[model samples]
Target: MNLLKIENIQYSYGKNTPFEKEVLKNISLEVNANDFIGVIGHTGSGKSTLIKICNGLLKPDKGQIFYKGENIWKKGFDLKHLRFKVGVSFQYPEHQLFCETVKKDIAYGLVNKGVPEEEQESKIRQVLKIVGLQESYLEKSPFKLSGGEMRKVALAGTMVLEPEVLILDEPTAGLDPKTTKQVYESLKEYQAKTSSSIIVVSHSMEDISEYATRLIALDDGNILLRGTPAQVFSNTERLNDMSLDVPITTSILSMLAQKNPSVNTNIYRYNDTKAEIIRLLKDVKSIE
Candidate 1:
């Protein structure tokens, strides 16, 4: 089933003023169950705007957004209810954390929804585990934690609600390599366990290539490419023309293909590319 659909939606900033500018133009996208979608583009490519529209944070200037076949902007449609079904964790989400303790921060949304206190505690524990945080840290101040831990807390806050679709913008921004890996691992586990969809906006070609089941490449508020990571990254010239880059592994494979036609340049995943190179070396040894 299509979990969310954006149909020919257009958005602009300063709509009627002298500085009016359209950020998204006739953009259409559909998210499905258990989808791990990556939205990639350079700055001002409307990646953030599109996700905001999905979360109901911003209204489109033209067109409609549908959640499970229901028009979200139609009269009597509850935007607040839509948010509970589709959660968003914007860039630098850690900065929004304000509760005195990690437990309180993660429970804020549940409290607002008037969930039972016992149920809130259970949900908090479940999400904390999902985000890779220990129960001991739950009693500590969220602000005192390491940067990565704080981000996970923010993520846990959103995950406690178990939204059908999770949207994140620059989820791993400013994190170290190990932390970045951990964050994605947690997200992958969460998606697998809940069978929920995820839409991530990231600048790291490498990260998105490694995890996303599908890729959407946006340029100048338009979708320039959309496909599996391999299919989209194969268009190296098109992405390069827009000042975007393919994954580092993809670039390496492309270079190898240029030097040796026998090299398989179709791979984009880091592990798969590594395995392919190993296989090629084994073939050379056998020939020798």
Candidate 2:
């Protein structure tokens, strides 16, 4: 079943002002329960604006947003409930951290939800582990942590609420390779444990190719492509036209296919590409 639906959504900034501009135009999409969706686009393609609308942070100038078949903007609708159900962690989430202690920062959502003080501690600890942070760091000021740790603390704050649909915008924006992998793995583990729908907005084609079950590519405020990673990545030409790159391994495979028609160019993951190369080498040796 579709957990969320956006139909014909059009959003504009500064509506009637001289600086007015439309950021999203007639966008429509469905997010199914437990689906891992990746949103990709060049900067200013409205990725952030679209998700803010999804969580009811911004009302669209036109069209409807439905959460479980009910329009979120319906008169007298309780949007606060929807906000809790669909948690959004914005870009540079650490910038949102504002508690004296990491534990308090992580428990902020729980407190807002009116969860008991005793339960808040348990939930905070659980989400802290889910975000791959040590319990020892909980008492430190969020500002005292490294960039990566601060990001995890910010993430833990959102996950502690146990939202049914978690939306993260550039969750690993500036981290090193190892830290990026850790963050992605933690997200995957949380999804697996909770069966929650996850929407990640990222520019890393490799990360999306490896983790996202579905992909959506935006251009000029419109959806240019939507499909599985394999389906979307296969259209390398179109993505390039949108000023987006495919996974590096996919690019390598494409180059290999140019020199050797026998090599499979459909590979995306490093492991899959490595296996195909080994098989091809074995075939060449057998012929020799």
Candidate 3:
């Protein structure tokens, strides 16, 4: 199920001036249901700008964006309704928090969409749990929560909309390792439960490679590459050529596997790599 499609999209900034710059150029991609899309690139790659266009926050100067096979920018399209369906959690979601309490902030979008008050509380609680925020924090001021908690609360607000597609930009930035792991695992579990498609914009392959079904690489306003994490990571030289680095583990294993085939590390994921190593060691010992 292709949930969203972007075709020949182009965006320009600072129009009507000699300083005009075009960020995206002839970009086309298909985003499917239940797909975890990881977008990676160096800074200024137009990744954020592209996603903004997807959610209707920005209209591209050229090309079309489709939702469920229909041109989303067509006349009579309800962009507000589309936004609710494809929830976008920006790079620093907490910065958008303005309500008095975490509960109100999370419920803000739902309320704006006219969901009943009774359903609002239920939805808020459900999404808060989905983002791993305790019930106690619901009443607290979002301004006072820790960085990680604030990020989760921000995500909770977005999930309350029950969107079919979620576009999260650098959701795990500036968090402690434990909280980052928790946020990642929480979203993974939520995706498993709901089977919702998620598109994450991030520079760190290490953050999402283990789970993202596809990775899209962008650089200097162009889509440099797109494929499964393993497939994309295989082109280490290309990644470097674009000023991006593969996951540290992938680079380490890739170098070692070439020099020492006995390493037998054929996996790009952590658990799979560990298990493969263990199985190989047991086989080696058995032969001895």
Candidate lDDT scores, in order, read 0.92, 0.92, 0.86
Write model 3 residue lDDT over 172-193, tens digit each, in one string: 8898878888887877877887
Model 1 Cα RMSD, 1 decimal: 0.8
In model 3, where do residues sit more than 4 Å from their true spots? 262-266, 283-288
Across residues 47-75, which tens digit of lDDT does each residue of candidate 2 receive?
Answer: 99999999999999999999998999999
lDDT of 3 at 145: 91
Ranking of all predicted structures according to TM-score, beginning with the best and ending with the worst? 1, 2, 3
Q: Once superposed on the true structure, which residue ranges of model 1 sit more than 4 Å away at CA?
A: none
RMSD after CA superposition, every candidate: 0.8, 1.0, 1.6
Clashing pairs in 3: none
- Please report how far candidate 1 places residue 18 from its true position, in Å: 0.9
Q: Output the TM-score of candidate 2.
A: 0.98
* TM-score for each candidate, following the candidate numbering: 0.98, 0.98, 0.95
lDDT of model 3 at position 124: 85
Candidate 3 — what's its lDDT? 0.86
